[model samples]
Target chain A: MQENFIKATAFAALLSASAAVGLTGAAQADSIKIGINVPQTGFAAADGTSALIGAQLAAEQANANGGVNGKNVELVVYDDQASPKSAVPIATKLVEQDEVKIAISGSYSGATRAAAGVFQEAGVPYISAFAVHPEITRSGDYVFRTSFVGEVQGRAGAKLIGESLGKKKVTLITLKNDFGQSLANGFKEAAEQFGIEIISEYEYSIKDRQFGPIVAKVKSDAPDAIYASGYFFTAGPLVSQLRSGGIDVPVIGQEGYDSQKFIEIAGGASEGVIITTSLDRDSDSPEAKDFIAAFEEKAGYKADMVAASGHTAMKVAIAALREAGSEDPKAIRDAIAGLTLEASTGTISFNGLGEVRKDVQVQVVKDGNWHRHSIISDPDLLAPPEK
Target chain B: MLAFELLLQGLVQGSIYALIAVGLTLVYGLLRILHVAHAGLFTLGGYIGVIVTNATGSLLLALLVAMPAMGLLGIGIYRTCYQPLLSRPPYVALIASIGLFIMMEELFRLIFGPYGLSFTAPPLQDTVAVFGVNLKEAELATMIGAVVLIGGLALLTLRTRIGTASRATVTDPKMAEAFGVNIGRIRDINFFVGSALAAAAGVMVALLNNLVEPTMGSVPSYKALAIIVLGGLGDLRGTLIAALALGVIEAYGTIYLGNLLDRDAIAFAFLIAVLMLRPQGLFGRA
Candidate 1:
């Protein structure tokens, strides 16, 4: 009697499992699956949450307007924790198990670059939202980036400081990481062309909140401007220390400092600080303006570059899905490569290497908020690598 | 002028290190167990300080509330996590402490959110010029606080009955127990005082950086471990000197060797060299 009962339970479980699979199969017929990998529970969780919200908002808006080819867009999300090891399995699961048509990475360079290889190997088109590592796009033609590469942004920073701000003597404070190294390289390469002289360069780790040594050295050097590479966590303390040290010169940062939290952390010292980024808080473009409004309403905070990048990636994906007229991975890849759509971040287009091609936006802190400073649109200087 | 400024900066940084490492050294002197979770207590103190300060708009009240709260928590940790494991090998307790630290960090992340919290109105944004060196008010506060608290601790240990009891317990717990020195109570006191010092350091660091996050204690945790070892394990005075020396060395090395290595790498390289030359530590009574 007990054996019969156990057999009956097993048969019920098998029947339910098949029914669940059948339900999913039926749902999959009218929906386009897009996988998203983000660092939801790690050091980059704040940015990851913002990026996820931005992507979700984009999907919601797309569905409201009628999804690609009359099919609802479904996002299969996973937490990468900003680690390469976590991202690899996530990428594989998204591609193999879920059979997602495409994937977007709203994570740091390490995780994004690692996942890019898996997506490439699986022949599934992948888009990196904001990771700036140069190697990410090098993964394959199947991978694309919707944000400025570190080198391009770094070059833009050089131009912003050297020409726009007219600061010839500069001190470079490089964060010891891929993001910082790439930016420093681009800044150095363009510094000479822009007639800027780099007197000294100092490197610090991401864990360092204290910038006493660098501040003292930079104060002694007394450069006309300082170009530093760091995210808000590091930049906030570094800038505060620099200002409190009485070395008040123009500090140029990259997209990493493009968050309101930087202002809060730096306090009054954030005033006059500038950064080269994609999102312009004072942008007059309707697309950017609408995105800012919608995102603020949805996320309940001021939109940052990461959020804008995530939103832009999703919009590009939806646009590509529509352009391809089907869910074929190759067709989606071709459409993405050929498409040029104005996004919340900026005008989005891909180069031969799947790197983004667009002018860099410069924003400065004024009255505790980011405002437009200028635009670095030098085509020759800002042109990304084609291959 | 640059040298003077760097020196002041180093002293300020060193004072914070001393405050943090003193607690770890005291705990080791009493229990012979590495208190890796002390770093977690430091992080918790910072979170409590920030939350309180933001709510009360008074830094003093924040510090007052955080110290006792953390002191109690430290005692609780000793009773629950360390007490049971104390019977086993030292490595077992050390491993448990490390696990506790990681768990505390994750708990902080889950409770406070991944992004760090900033003081609503951080004090010491103004600079005061002294001897041609501009010092931040926050730095000055940290230095002064460290000196007073550490000095008070020194007096208490040297002049008070509890100090004698603690030293007795440290020297020979079994003998001290026979001599009517409550060894368990002394251990509790050791953890309470040590954790309170960590709390002070945590709050000061949060003020100094104007940002507090879950992983803020990680660097200081390992650095304190390196420092206690460098200063001779269980030696408070040695830890103090080692902490200051490290801060100054880091200040100088960052400018000189920064291009060659990272700030943390520079610190560890110095540690490795020191350990190789003197395995007993800088002041470990060789």
Candidate 2:
């Protein structure tokens, strides 16, 4: 019994020694660490990869200008795999293990939503690069979003679908998730304002690639337009299926559909698909031109809306850090809440809800490329409706 | 007219389901290995098919090359992962298969990137009118290919020597071995044929959908699992029939009910309902 007790004590001592070494190893104060939680695999991996590129560019630019009060910014990235279950642990690792003052989520809404509570509980400032779910920012004051809320994008989409395109009767196909449901709700609420009648609303699983029955229903109903609320993967096949099934109504989507991959997947069926996004690729602004040139050169491809949002979010985080002139999370959060800067997407300023009120670009697919259609600058349209 | 169109749509979907599930059933019936990695093979087949199609500009060539390649891969998988685990518990082999599935998905993601890839063949993009209903060319190809392959498999099992040996081994392995049948060789051949069927399903699905991604195998694979179970695990004819029924039900349900349950959920719901009434599945022997 005495030998067993001694063994237990020795084991306990070893564990303590190891843990101390680990904690000391992680708490090094060499550079400012900004935790990056992005989906490197799974459904949203493409967007995550693009967002990573944009974040890296932001870090490079900041470092070139001498990062945040003479201390270089170090981006510590982790793959949340676009899953909420994965995001929780990743958030804990970023805050407690990596000792980061702030975290940037470049993943989809699900992951960002999952990590927000953790960051808030830990009192670490959290910023979502492109996730647009309104509830993300509403999680707590510590959480902020560089992208506009889904409700804002959906309202703009409804206006474009109803008043601008003059399609009064519509069929809605939603993705059956938080992002899709919220967007659909926003569109449904505002759809009546412009005399647009929603003939039918069909929800589908994200895993669904077959749209035969859905297409048949759309054909029989024969609405003036079809608004699909999903990401580019679903939108691509949904458009292809609809067109191939010979139901060629105007198809409209939100920012999730704004990617070159969508056009490629749709294979000419993407023509005339109107989408509301945050970035205008053809903007003539000198700042836009310069940002685009620099981004393309660094990224080795054209920057999409998500990539621009990521770059903008990183810039905002850095700006907050600089303005605070300290590494305190509370100070950084305060600086971010009051930040106002011109971004590649537009002028970024946070509302009371910590959601960015920025320009939303409207684009259309024509001749297999995204062409600028119009810009919705109305603040009333951009603001999230009172809860 | 709408009902008729829905029936045809069901048949198209059912054909693809059967194409995928049949191989899974075959492997499970003879080996009792579960073969969860079958879905990964299907996705690999899609990648190979697309690569070949782009390189040769012939969908036919893609189909031919992808099947053989996947068949060879199946043999390699059996040799490397399964053969050593044969002496261990069956669940050990299942765990290995799950590991393989994850690795294959990661490899495909690394090779193809995370975006959805277009698998369009220009000649197959045109839609054809079938009984006054518009159907994509790939759908027609899928139906025809499924029929030929399933029919051929049925015939081979009914009228071939290897088929008889395979049945013998599955029924009583020790007895079959006593009668001079090499059970190991039979298992290898079955794995090859099963994996080839999964690959074929992958190619057809990619063609019909006009897009393929690394994670494409996961959903269909889960559906395939439900299919194998609901069709009375390891029952060949039962799996085929259940697959068709599932397709028709999913079609009509999605149309009339309007996404009250997701199409995949509808399938599981059907499986549960059927299992409640008949626990041995539709065709499991007493």
Candidate 3:
């Protein structure tokens, strides 16, 4: 009994020491570790690394300016592999094992959805950067994103097409996954509201390469424009096949087309295409400029919106952490819901579930590049365009 | 316009199905092992071809490197993962193959990064218009390459000594072994040949689409399984015919459904019906 008591006492001592280390061990703590969960490899590998680089640059810049509460931030990353099945274990490791209080993630909506549940259960705050699924915010208070839901992007895209570009006959070519489908559905509702006739709609598999038949049928519909909202893998070929078929209609897409490689794949054909996205690298916002410059210098490549979103998510979480002055999940969640930061993207403020409520911006693909096309109307806009 | 475009596109996709299925059928004919790992190898080929193109900036060089690399990797994988399990339950090797597929895919993810690699098909981006229907130069190339690969596989099986030995081994492994034929060597060669063809198919896909990902092989791999079942597992002639049929059917299905219905469902559903009707496969040795 004495031996058992001694062992228990030793274990308690160790626990106290670890807590001391976990909390106030700043001098010896090396840095405040925040887990960066994204798909660093797999289908989302490219954007995953881009997001990681943003987190890395943010942590670096934060340290350069003397980190949060004098504790340098450390980013310990785990690759969610862009698969829902893979995200659970990685989130488990981050929350239960690594014990990081805050994480930024979500390369694929499905993966983000899978990880969000794990984080909420574990009382760890997770910020999704590029995953814009509307359902993700419903995961709970602990889950948040720098990017708004697809509903926003979709409605904005439909508005831009209906009100701005003046095209009525439309067709949607979307990835059939829930994330892509949700956006398509959102666009469909909005387009109908705008009195647009979506002559036809098509959904492709996530890995489908040949878009020959899909594009051909859309051409038959003779829609004034097409909306393809999958990533470069599927979208590139879709555009290529469209061009080959002489369907030369103006193609507008979602955030998936924001990557540099998208243009690289679509090349000459991608010119004059437009896509709705969170923030363009060429944003006139000073914060956006600074972040882009630092990111470009660090990664030795142009920064994508996904990377910018991740850095912005960290900024949101870190700001909330400071406001709460504690690592408690509930406190942080409340602080995030009330966050108001002039971030690189825009003024980020969240609704009840901690998802940012922001305007959706439409960007045009011109000269084989994505450039701001229009400021998508919000209630805050000079005037919300006529309904 | 949509139907016409869908037809040409479906033909291109169908061609790819043919390329992938032929190799799968070949392996089943000789080894009697349904290698799920071939998909991993197929995906590996795409990524490898991308890397080769990036580093060397030569499409030809990328093909040269990825093809032989996949072939050699196939032989090595068979020796390490399958050879020992050959004597064990047949299902054992298949399960091991699934594990190996996971491991190889994870390793690929580690090495290749998750985002797909893009190959610039500047030359082939040009299209040829026939009967007011658009056909991409890349798709045409893909079909041509598929034909060549299938033709070569057929010729190799008919003419070569190793091919004859493989035939003998396929007819009766025990008799071939007693006749002093090196069954192990034949298996290794067969695996290498199958994997090499899959790599070639990968190159075609990458070239045709200008994109490749580690998980890219999964869809084609599953399609190959569907085709094998439909064609009669061990029957080469039926596999080819099934590939074309699947390709055309999927293309039309995508169009008829107005793009909402995924064409893969058609292949999968057909596979289920076939399994119910013919447990031994449509064209497998009766």
| Chain B TM-score list for all models | 0.98, 0.96, 0.91
Name the candidate, 1 or 3, with the larger TM-score value: 1
Docking quality category of candidate 1 according to DockQ thresholds: acceptable
lDDT of candidate 2 at residue B85, scale 0 to 100: 74
User: Please, what are the lDDT tens digits per residue for candidate 1 over residues B1-286?
Assistant: 7777778888888998999999999999888899999999998899888889999888899899988888899999898878877768888778778867876876788799888899999865688877878888889899999999999989989999999999988889999999999888998988888899899998998998999998899898899998999899999899999999889888888888887877777657878998899988999988
Give lDDT per model, in order.
0.89, 0.85, 0.76
Off by over 4 Å in 3: A1-33, A83-99, A118-124, A328-330, A380-387, B1-7, B51-65, B159-162, B258-261
In model 2, the clashing pairs are none
Candidate 2 residue lDDT tens string, A1-387: 234335545765785476446433543366788988988877778999899888878888898898888888888888888899999998999999888989899998889999999999999999998887778988888988888777778788899988889999999999888788888888887888878899998888888888888888788888999889888888888899899999878898988887888888888889999899988878987656667788889977777888888888898899999999999899999999899987778888887778887877998998988889999888887785333
lDDT of 3 by residue, B195-219 (tens): 8878878887877777777678777
lDDT of 1 by residue, A1-387 (tens): 234335545765785476446434434567899999998765788889888888988888998998889889988888788999999998999999989999999999999999999999999999999998999999999999999888888889888888888999999999998999999999998998889999989999989999987898898898999999999999999999999988889999989998999999999999999999989988989999999999999988899999999999999999999999999999999999999999988887888999888889999999999999988888899999887
Each candidate: fraction of true contacts kept?
Answer: 0.72, 0.62, 0.69
The full ranking of all candidates by DockQ, starting with the best, is: 3, 2, 1
- Model 2 chain A poorest 10 in a row by lDDT: A19-28
Candidate 3 clashing pairs? A41-B114, A42-B114, A45-B114, A45-B115, A46-B115, A203-B259, A213-B6, A216-B2, A217-B2, B232-B283
DockQ of each: 0.40, 0.41, 0.45
Candidate 1: Cα lDDT at B52:
92
Please identify which of the two predictions, 2 or 3, would achieve the higher lDDT against the true structure: 2
